[model samples]
Target chain A: MTGAIKSQSGRLTEAEAIERAKQGDGEAFEVLYNLHKRRVYSLCLRMTANTAQAEDLTQEAFLQLFRKIGTFRGESAFSTWLHRMAVNVVLMHLRKKGLPVVPLEDTMETDEDTTKKEPGAQDASLAGAVDRLELQRAVEALPPGYRSIFVLHDVEGFEHNEIAEMVGCSIGNSKSQLHKARLKLRDALKKHRAEKAKR
Target chain B: MNCAEFQKALPEFAEPQRDTALQAHLRSCSDCSLLVSDLDSIVAAAPSLAASEDPNPQIWLQLEAALKNEGLIRQPAAPLLVPPPQEGRGWRLSWALPVAAAVALTIGLLVYRPSTHQNLQSTGKTAVTEPAAAVQTAAATNAGINEDQDLLEVVGTQSPTMRAEYAANLKDVNAYIRDAEDAAKANPDDEQAQESVMNAYEQRSMLYEMAMDRSLP
Candidate 1:
């Protein structure tokens, strides 16, 4: 077991904490959990749109991290590694529940349809039109496959290649899914705005 | 450039440089321009959503209990201190861990058959078999150790992320099986001892099956 080492701020650096955690230090594990829990939970919440399920998934992700922390060779940033694990955990749960993470037919769309104008493409631009809360609600209402892609690409800032690897789709499919997700979200925001005007 | 051509190339425009044809289309077409603007705004606003929100504090407590139950951590003489949740909602410790183990064990015992091994190997895809069955059958018959070694070799070929965890878990389960087997041998007449040995083998079989599933591409 490695001794606890602290930086000038008198707190254990993430590296030191990881080392201690690998040794099964409970406090070190807690430290790592606290550091990453909110982000992991937020990811789960966005993907599932259910707080309780997100919480459960968050717990499961951390448990997995603890079990595998000894294997952390630091090849990538810890957050990146953890997020990948978190994403896999959520994806596996969704898969077990029989939800489509990415529909094969959607990914197989011809280039012509992929580039064709979406319905109501002439609507006012969503630039500055939708607020954060409304956008979030709209995101929650998206189909499971679209929501997963949108959240991973747009919200989580993963590259198309990374998203493809994580979700088991081709890079082209990831991009197409993200674009379609945006188009759907645009339609949703426009509908919300129209409803607000009626009110 | 027509709307179709411009939109076809739009995803590439996300990069800093935009070609003159796409630019010219954006200049002439209001709808295409608005589509670009809207997509950009959506992309811009997306990052704000990444701002982290804390989960309920009880989650850590529940997680701690689970880790302890798995023998992954030492039990402290006293409960570790943590801040209380703002609400008085009582959290229940889940029986999922034990229940899942029991289910896996049942599956392992039910699926074990000696004949399936040759079929699995013939396909060159042992992972395709029901994990518990493949593992339980392997562990039960004369070729148990060699089959497990072969499974471990397959596991070794998996990606790094899956490999370490599988190795660690298999090591733990193997130790558990040894302990149970020794207990049964030391008390041959005890039905409880015999049952413990059976349960331990079941657990080992399930763990091997889990490893196989994870090893799949």
Candidate 2:
């Protein structure tokens, strides 16, 4: 009841596990990390596309989390609080390297002749109406802003207000981005389906 | 509301409150129905992307090491939507005890009383008690001794510029004292000359030491 129990129990009734971890209990913090790392890492991966950069961003995000965890209050759900932190970490990493801003135009129209050059070109012959792989490829191929908004809103289930605050934009901007994301996703799925038809 | 507004509100509709008008539209409009189905699929596929698994064990190790090092429970760069006020409270709280202790110590030192002592060697003075005379003599001698010790300490520790200034000032005072002694030998029983010479020497010594002390980093 001294270390681990104190932190876990203390978090529920007295303070949160995150709060306790900030006070210096490594184990208590580990529990909090385990709970959120998957979603955080996934967001980083989808944002970066490359495994190495995603891993680096994920690690940096968690490191920053620990460095600044003392600032967290239970005003928002812990996951929501962590999501804002995670997204900022990825965005900052992208900004630092001057990575191309994923344009907002939706690029929904892919040239038919260039279809075979897409990442999932080999999967064109695979048989399925809609699968996770197809959806993931579609999401990943989305412009960064729309992909991020789509993932945060539809995939991660954040509200537009939360997305707006995290992404540094207005709620109106978030909704517009989500609409663009959805339309792009819908187009990609349509193209995917059309490709299936030709095979 | 028309289908466009209804569709915009459809995402919001999932949260247990679906407007009656939107529900009515959903029942009638095939387009809205398809939109709902499309949203359902998007939502379904959304979690699968979330299916990106936990990081490798090494990353957990690194994260744990990082948290332990930083004493952090969550990410630090972006604060939560609502940051905790406890951190500010804690920051302010940290200074309270140290400040209180410093104030107490300063007060205690300021109010401290030194012990009394007597002098048997004082030549009889009118109203001054033997003990008071001894105390005054002791204080004067101690002051002179402390000044000399302070000068030596400063010489040992001060930077070269300060040391050179101090050494030069000390030589000038010594020379002035020598000149005053020569004058005193030449003209004995001149109280004014003796007093001025003594005062000049004491003031010079004090200035040299203070300058030395000031020059220390």
Candidate 3:
């Protein structure tokens, strides 16, 4: 048996921590939980839009992370691996509740109502003009598919192909979803701006 | 290009690619140009979330209790590794039964994985591909052996700016290291947790080395 790790002198690496967690090191598992809880919670919050649910899911994700720590083959980045697990957990939870993971076909339209003004074509009334927080709220208001695409592409910096693989959509569909998501955000921002102007 | 074509290409507008027809359309069409600019801002204004806000700390206790419920990491604290968290003693190691198992595992990893050794040798110089085992062995090798002098050698090699950045980030690193220490020293009977501690250290070393190596000309 190898001696104690002499914690004072040596720094912990993620790989070492994961191996320890797999061996049932509760403290090592705690470190892993601390390391990733925020991102996991943030993802849950974005997906669920409920802080309590997000917190619950974050806890659930870590619990699952520790349980499944042994199966981690080290093929991908731990962050990627953990995020993927979190996404799967969120998706699974959403499915179990019968919530919509993808929006209806009608919602896929960039502008469902032709009569409504084109949010993108309007200068000074959209995008940069909108409050940052308002824009984020607008994002929060997006449909499941739109929100996931937007978060994965813009906020999370994933490639379209990666997004497609993650969400099980075609690459073209991913692009179209992003476009629609942006359009929705722009429309919401435009409305916020108009309302602000009136005030 | 027409409005749809221009809009489709908007995501790539950040790249300097000129389309004569697209340029002509943008030049003549106010609506198209406005839309293009709007799309650009939508992309630009997105908040790159890093989970900046730490989650509630109670989750740690919850997680630990849950592990205990599952029969993991429920070991009695070893005699040698009982440094309290409030002690502010910097980095420390917890030697326990699970940690001993992890040492064996680390040795097994080192012996079984030869490529990892080669990868460790030139860590900062090249991109380290196999992060799992390779990072663990490399990081663990340096840890606990020479402690202060070794850290100086690694940190000392970095550029001043990099060293400053390392100093700034050390608090978090120390915290992480502290977590590993607490687990191993306190109650790492569950070899899983001990293994995780060792892997975390390896990854930290790889990151530290990678950061330091980047500053080299």
Candidate 4:
């Protein structure tokens, strides 16, 4: 009966929840939290690779979200806005800890490994050689730069331009880094599979 | 196309929609074909990877308590996820339950019984409104505290962090209780002070119940 909108399930839609949350509705904020905590927390954990720090960042991101929710003008999808905020939270924390953010400059020269051909990767029609668990482990073990681009591109499904905008890198840098990320993940997965075969 | 050219263009081949030339190269060139297949599988598999954990409720509790401490929201009747006091830091809290109960009971008896109510209605004063009334009410409040001690003990053993959280949340609630006590002392018959003191008691009870609700594994 109130002016607030509700979705089909009788719960407030994300937009309504956001509106209520902006008005200082705690339950509405919790509704938003419950809906996206998994994705946000997962993004934080993947980016930081430290559970405690990730948890801290997750909370910090949401608190910052609450503070900045007023500024959101519905220009982008809420998820994109939230994910970008989460990414920024992790980046800021990393900066505060004096961890160097790998400058995402466009590189003209290719890396030696990217230039090297993977013989097995060339002709084979892929079956199940790439294990999900193995690949996941490889990703978690990636350096922060590669891990983020990979997660943002392949995992979170952001386009190169979106990735560039979020991380303050060029679209070209995003594409380059994503290529390198995939290559490193391939190497990591191959090594993992080989180690398991040995065991 | 030679494998060199095919390999160089592999990044382009990774896009979801490959142009005819790239697809043609992937079809004819074994090495390029295999590379594309492997890369395709990799891209397909990436989105499934996720962190295996979520931020637990304690974080929410802390954030909310912080917001409340900063005077952001109107004070919630009882704080959420208040961690109990840290062990050996018991002196920081004012055990408002006993004192609050005493005040509530003294006020109740003064206004409730027919004879007392009639006398107070007629004269606007009662025998039980004297300072001695609080001393007598203290005995009943001590019994209530002893019972609450059991509840606190049960709530205490659950999580050190939760108890710590309870302590943090109660710190604010106690501040409210302290302010109400100041008002009550300044004006012994102040209705607002008496109501606030009782509200603090009710809020404390709700906080204890919140602990019980949370103690479930």
Score candidate 2 by lDDT: 0.55
TM-score of each: 0.61, 0.48, 0.59, 0.60
What lDDT is obtained when candidate 4 is compared to the true structure?
A: 0.61
Where in model 4 is the C-alpha error above 4 Å?
Answer: A1-12, A98-110, A115-126, A129-131, B13-17, B50-52, B75-217
Tens digits of lDDT, candidate 2, B180-208: 54544343344434543453445454444
Evaluation by DockQ, superior candidate among 3 and 4: 4
Q: Scoring each candidate complex against the real one, what DockQ results? A: 0.19, 0.14, 0.16, 0.16
lDDT of 4 at A164: 82
Off by over 4 Å in 2: A1-20, A99-130, A197-199, B1-36, B64-217
The TM-score obtained by model 4 is 0.60
Docking class of 2: incorrect
lDDT by residue (tens digit), candidate 4, B1-217: 5767666565554562367767777677765666666677898887666533435546666777665565544424222332356683332223443354345445444432345434564795656464454664455456545645544544455433233334534544445445555555564544545655555555555554455555433
Best by TM-score: 1
lDDT of 4 by residue, A20-113 (tens): 7677666566557656776888788777777688778988888888778878888988877887888888877877886634334435346555
What is the DockQ score of candidate 2, to 2 decimals?
0.14
Better of 3 and 4 by TM-score: 4
The 10-residue segment of model 1 chain B with minimum total lDDT is B89-98
Question: Scoring model 4 with DockQ, what do you get?
Answer: 0.16
In model 1, chain B matches the true chain B with a TM-score of: 0.33
TM-score of structure candidate 3? 0.59
Docking class of 3: incorrect
Q: Which ranges of candidate 3 are over 4 A from the true structure? A: A1-11, A107-132, B8-24, B74-217
Give the winner by DockQ.
1
Tens digit of per-residue lDDT, candidate 2, span A100-162: 333344355432322223454433322323466568778878867677778777777778887
